[model samples]
Target: MEQNNMQDLLKRYLEGNCTPEERAQVELWYELLDSKKAAANEAELEEDLAEVRTRLAMPFRKKGKLFRYPAVAAAAAVLLIISIGSYFYFNNKPSGVPQKANKLLATDIAPGRNIAILQLGDGTEIALDDQSNGAIAKSGSNTIYKNAKGQLTYVATESKEDETDNPVSNSLRTPRGGQFQLTLPDGSQVWLNAASQLTYKISKTSRERLVELKGEAYFEVAKDANRPFKVLSKGQVVEVLGTHFNVSSYDDDPSVKTTLAEGAVRIVETGGHRNVVLEPGQQATLDSSNRLSVAQVDVSDAIAWKNGKLNFNQSDIYAVARQLSRWYNVDVVFKGRAANVRLSGEVYRNTNASKVLEILAFYNLNCKIETNNGVKRIVIE
Candidate 1:
């Protein structure tokens, strides 16, 4: 290949877009680069490796290979490719960096500010984070209370309009890595996840109940079959008469997932393009391309965050890093290839940063934990 063609091939190889033959050529090109020279471009080298590894993970149907054990198989394939090139590339470099050390990016979501702003219908904003957790407002004979645990609740108060007491609604949002619980006017319970926002409006006892969510949340909605409950996520809407379920629709996430625990729910995407009727114990995933898929998953695992547990079952390194980022409020940067290390475990939600890092370290993954000026940086191996 000419110089330009070689450069394009290198770029494509690093982006995980190269074919198997192109991959072989990449090894030869890396062999031509002197290690002393390459070491100066260490960061670029790592990026290229990440992209290559990502491409290796793609399924190869032509190979007639079953996709079972995708992560392990992909890791093995990438390792084979790296072995072909590393002989020439690293022999000339210094031995200070361990040959077997895996450099991984420790990408994590920043910690929550333990902050929330309540927007009432009257356009009043209440800074919930700074206030003492207690009864903060009253609506239509219903008392609004915020507990020390950061949960908001509503209780019935005397009403002059009729025998039945009406409920009120308000907006609640938790900043990144923070969580709060809520009891709606209709006696429905909601647990907001980090970086989540929800809006609830008051309703008469006989009217429909509606709310909006951005990010993850667990809902134990009050049962009133006469009045259906609807939750609006970014581009999808979940409508249920009375059900217990969880919905994750973080705009940053690639897909919208809704897991149902009990009762029934109708998940509808915008423009009436996709619709799914989910049953209890069923989870639905809506991708950016508007494809809908349903599968059976353990509801307990899906809603573990609400119970103060970080549960993982056969989860990959990237998935684990995501959970840690949300729970501990740190940033995770992987230094090199993050292998297909499947883990099944649980950690207490309130565990300190070092403890979490120590647990991750046991997985053959190196981690460097540092805190500077209240910001935590977690570097992965």
Candidate 2:
């Protein structure tokens, strides 16, 4: 639609006369707005919106007034309308509706934290969460410690490596609503996301560095000319001399994704029959059928958990829901037909899950959080 018509539609939406389909589409555009750093509090935003309703009707609803001012300006009615209109015009979406947003509860479900368990070669498990920073344990020839800086590191001396002719193996695993960073004996750093695990084995007798992964992890591998770093996840293996990359191998996901951030990586299917090389900003996905496809991607989406953000940019409802389920430790159920909507914008990792649900529900009109049998869930219609 034309920008002028887009502006008129915004006026009608605020007047509460939009059709259901129009309303849903407009709200989807609202979700696309970048409010991650909005200076206004929730209450203030709502109050200003009420005033905006009156002001929108009185003036500036005239034809072609859209985009008369700078965007990302405060949620002033004219500016927001213009911004939304511009988005609609450029993206080829029809004009949509508006509704008073409902307030989100400060629900008990909190965000994920730095928590994980370390299992030694001797079969001993150490709870790393709530443990004070200090020397944590000794595994084979490796002395494991959690430094004051909160990095879990292992120190292996040459003599100790010699003492252990047999390889020493250990695993670091994170549960739902948990995350962690581990520095391997060879100095490669791995950041494990929620519901993920990384297992590594090292030996002086071995020539290569290898680690097995389940779920997702970001790696900053330490370089050694003699030893190439290799990551083995379901269906695929990634080999790099020394580089930064992220691997997501969730069992529930249809594909295992390996994203290269800083260096080159060679990815091979488990059978070693198919292979692909990736450059920075590229990704290789191994599907359930063992077919591999390469493409360029936004690397931030792959490592957003490590960087402390939840991204919804150009994402479907199910994709956004899966991230929330992992970080909030909740199950999502569809009450009727799933919303089948897409979302955009990035939320602070620190924000409560309820706040997100509120925004999502505001646009979709049929999503909310509830507790049944003491288990938290997001019910979608």
Candidate 3:
């Protein structure tokens, strides 16, 4: 590789585009410099690392904060990260860092922000992040707005004519590392979590206000005695008149969880006769094997994501890894025998990936950050 292209190579390595040999060369280069006090240009290496971090938009490690971990997998007492001066190396490079760590090496994934996509009734898509705080579209008798608080709201206006029959639908979708809030035509409020979608009927002629949920969402439904609000998720229909609840039915999850916070809700099986009526502080779970069960639970843990926190209360490492993966938009891979670990902690959703990994390290699990084609992955050993 040309001397000048080292920057390019580093970027390729960070972006997961580098070949195996190229990656090894980069790590070998790190090994050569970790302790080598060769009188070469120290300024050049510093500039290269800084430029790579900037190009990849990685968060810089704090200058003096030390990452402490106990003996973990025979690697306990390993100091994972030192102040922003530790050298970056490849897999299984070493057990410890040198005297001074390198400044700004590329590898932290940022947390998700307020982001979502809105599909208009006619099929026009609007990226919520790109639009300003104003009316974004008109749906029948309602005007949609990206409000000042960044919520997609449907405000009812005087109707000139009817736009109904099959229910004119508008949808909101949040990609990985994204979330959004919106109000429906029926005055219901919804908080769409990361990698989730909510499609609500905008037409007022329907006798029942209906919406389809794919991933997960928190609903604060508006009470309408005449029109019962129904959410059609995978295998179940959550019917509510006026209540607050959460439904998690992601494809990756092993079950569909419907947690009720306030009021009451009835969970009806899509094609079966199984049903359960839930009261406050109750949870109804529909498992993969088509089993329906209800239990008393703490509802806060269910809506923690909506309130800007990662609550891993009574969660195993795999569950924690999945939450981290969705929030940080990273894939998680276990390299060796996976740890039999369950954890309980609350971390704000606004922090970067390193902060959460540091929490994992505290529990003695080895976590590493890797990248491929602009996506970050959390690798555990």
Candidate 4:
């Protein structure tokens, strides 16, 4: 069909005046365009669409008036009509309605949210999400507050000698489908990922500011020339005067990855008897064999979760499943050859599980959610 004829057909289809065959053809064109948009990067995709719009505006240019249709509607019609040829040429197999791919799931799972628990030194657990913005607790000279934005902060007050004598530790932990940020007494900031924990002590007299981490967290250390900051995770200790970095030491993950965003850090692996210094934009990975390696990487991708986005760049199916499991609080079971497939893209963390699975299906990977006894499981094939 000519461009002009195809555009007319699409306009009729959009207006619900097309025959069944014409509607199917338009819908198939849209499906192909959506698949291409999903695979293209944001900037490149926008450029390509702009060219399409120019070509689509030619017919209207022949007339003295502008296109009567809205810009969005016009763009959609153009995309549908342009893909008509490719849709028929490449897809010769019997084409039925795409089977609402993600609907096979028994239940839809939601994404992670800002939620965490704070465990005080005295064995008290405070649900940070339940508490309002105010002073929640007091630990010796340190006052703990949950701010309006759901962040936990620690402020120190002058105390008597007796109260200052004993140093108390506090831990901020995020359950599955939850994440939280914290401001330490010394002014350092920490963003904890889902299913992660960070423990630190508040003592003005302490020479060093140290914290232990499990799973993943991004840290922005406060500069203290006299006191170095240290993070302990999976038998590895990262020491710095002041720096921004991310650490991932989840038990299920095979390696401990530390990516430096700014400044410098010295990573020491106690078990491996190895030490390495990482500069800005460098990542150090300590594998199961206790070997440490360094390489340059995109720092934003490493900290995307803390920024409320999921960046999967050449990530294997198992890695993608692990992230989904953490953010959705669901168990994942892989059958067949699901673990070997790799994917790359960025999506909002707040998107629902069904939409996420649907995006995965566009990459030719099969995934479904199953619920049994109130527990949801994602099976990838």
Candidate 5:
């Protein structure tokens, strides 16, 4: 594979002075060189390669000093090698390749649109929409308000005599593509991601800090050794005390993923398993294997959706496609054997999905997008 040996092989093959097997070896090396050069200018490289192939096919001419100009040919050979190298790198690399960048897709769910609702204890409903900044209403002694970012904040009125009321729950609901943050009556903070819901009561009067979650949410539980914070997701229960963690138990997704960012959490399954403890940077999953699996992961990426970005260090095409479908509300299909395609990189949640697909196509992995029955579907080209 040295440069000199490669050049000698090419020269011999072009001169039609090598055996059939030797000629094949030279042709393979030339193809590899062509690919390397193509990374910069694919279209132009294709043209040059075609012309060089024609010249190479013709019988070699004997000029005294012509072979001295191997530099020109060497440059071309390296370019081809790089291009082919890129192809193999992408195709044969391990899963979760970072080359397939993330893109924002068109959705039944659009970005930056606010759609959240609040329900009070006595069954009173507040639209939360069209509510001006600052105080919106009062529930008992607490004043409900909206901040500049449209998050709901509750301020309890000061009174000379303290009296605690029975625990009554209020719920925060976020529609698809919507997210909002709130501090519960108990001073515990909850960040609700798209299409998620959390129900909690005010802190002091409540016996313990408890919240029920559907979909995804990041919790920063207030430390109350006497009153443990419990998060109920589906039939699973996660108990924590003054810790930071993210839970993704969306019914639409196959598994319930609980990633611990700080402190510790005890996850309880429905089938009478005592508890599974998670450490920081650890993820516990209730996968299709009917077993709970735990592993160390990049905690930041596991919770990136809360920050309005899709961060993929090395993700497979299928996983990326599934994320796009959920975020953009699209369906994806594959026409070719794209099983080995891996992608990397990050993208904003607000960009168009088509642009991302086009970039992938540039890498020789083609994709076609179509609209069907008012739904968008993408197929591998």
Candidate 6:
């Protein structure tokens, strides 16, 4: 395919307008590019990589895909075939690296996996990480099951006459370095991020489906006009009949961001009685003073974590540190000018802390891993 044609297809794919065949063709081209790069010599590899970076630096409009960097989109261009493997290979190498002094401290601090704790209404806690797949517990008219993929699902059965009036509430929590997904009694699905909690009541009597959340979560609400789905996070409440959206309300973060992927939502700030409505691809931010602001955004970037990727678009070092702290369950200490550094890229969530820090080093941000009484700390200078 020609360069312009390939770029057009990629734009269409990012905009969710590509047909199945076109999507497959682009994917196959990407695979071939990676394979070819793997077999290329160092000189040829570097040249192709430079072209990839140049293509990535091309500016795109807001209405198109929100790429953290042009290099991300450039990788899909058939005119310039570059392997992404070179980046990983170069960034992961530790030979003659200055940060090698603290290499030993980087051990054991790995990426997070599927893990959570399920608390029944009776105050009984089940360690979801240790539990095997299958039915785990029963809450009133709901049957809680853990699937082979570690997702917790709720199946509603015929409600007993005695349980109709009494609704039992259950809570699911993901500690630092953990994450989990669950299907609510009403069929609404939610993916909870690290150090987050979600509480919802399961009953057939209630006309509204409501959930309380802390930290961050991506919701795919089931449509039921009669019973509106509502989410309460921090001091804000988001009400929607049925839609796909994400909410970020981490206590340590200064702002709460609600991004909608499809349909519509109404955000109500309980602290100030303020409300705002959001459309698809729009984000509403609530600051400390309960002030609300809305802006156009790339919904895919907002839900990147749920898709197993960390995306940074002109984000500062502190923002990157926050993500690392949650995923690796480690503390980040900025010693010098590290916090001012800005980064833009996409990385798999499963990448090790050391590898990620190494990539930061490429951008002139020095980092080292330190251990104090067995607790790992990432110190940037």
By lDDT, rank the candidates, best first: 6, 4, 3, 2, 1, 5
- lDDT score, candidate 5: 0.65
TM-score of each: 0.66, 0.74, 0.72, 0.75, 0.64, 0.78
Q: In order, what is each prediction's RMSD in angstroms?
A: 12.9, 9.6, 13.5, 11.1, 14.6, 8.6
Per-residue alpha-carbon lDDT of candidate 3 for residues 201-280, written as tens digits (9 for 90 to 100): 77667788889999999999999999899999999999999999999989888899999999999999887869999999
Q: Which lDDT value does model 3 have at 226? A: 94
Error of 4 at 228 (Å): 0.4
Better of 3 and 4 by lDDT: 4
lDDT of 6: 0.75
In terms of lDDT, the poorest run of 10 residues in model 2 is: 67-76
> Candidate 3's error at 257, in angstroms?
0.5
Per residue, candidate 4 scores C-alpha lDDT tens digits across 164-237 of 75678989999999999999988999999999999998887899988999999999999999999999999699
Runs off by more than 4 Å, candidate 4: 1-98, 102-106, 158-163
lDDT of 1 at 315: 78
* Candidate 3 positional error at 45, Å: 36
Query: How much RMSD separates candidate 1 from the native structure?
Result: 12.9
> Model 6 compared with the native: what TM-score?
0.78
Over the stretch 1-381, how does candidate 5's per-residue lDDT look in tens digits?
A: 433354345434333355667756756755775656645444545665674576455443345433321222323333343333344323444222123322223332344345578888888777776677888776656778888775787778787253357566788887765678887655777888867889877646555777899988898887989888999886578999889999988876778899999999999876765469999999989865447878988787778777666654446777777676656656678886776755543445664565455334433566656667877676774
Off by over 4 Å in 3: 1-106, 159-166, 372-374
Candidate 6 stretches greater than 4 Å from native: 1-108, 159-162
Once superposed on the true structure, which residue ranges of model 2 sit more than 4 Å away at CA? 1-103, 148-150, 157-162
Q: How close is candidate 3 to the true structure, as a TM-score?
A: 0.72
Global Cα lDDT for candidate 1 = 0.67
- The per-model lDDT (C-alpha) reads 0.67, 0.71, 0.71, 0.75, 0.65, 0.75
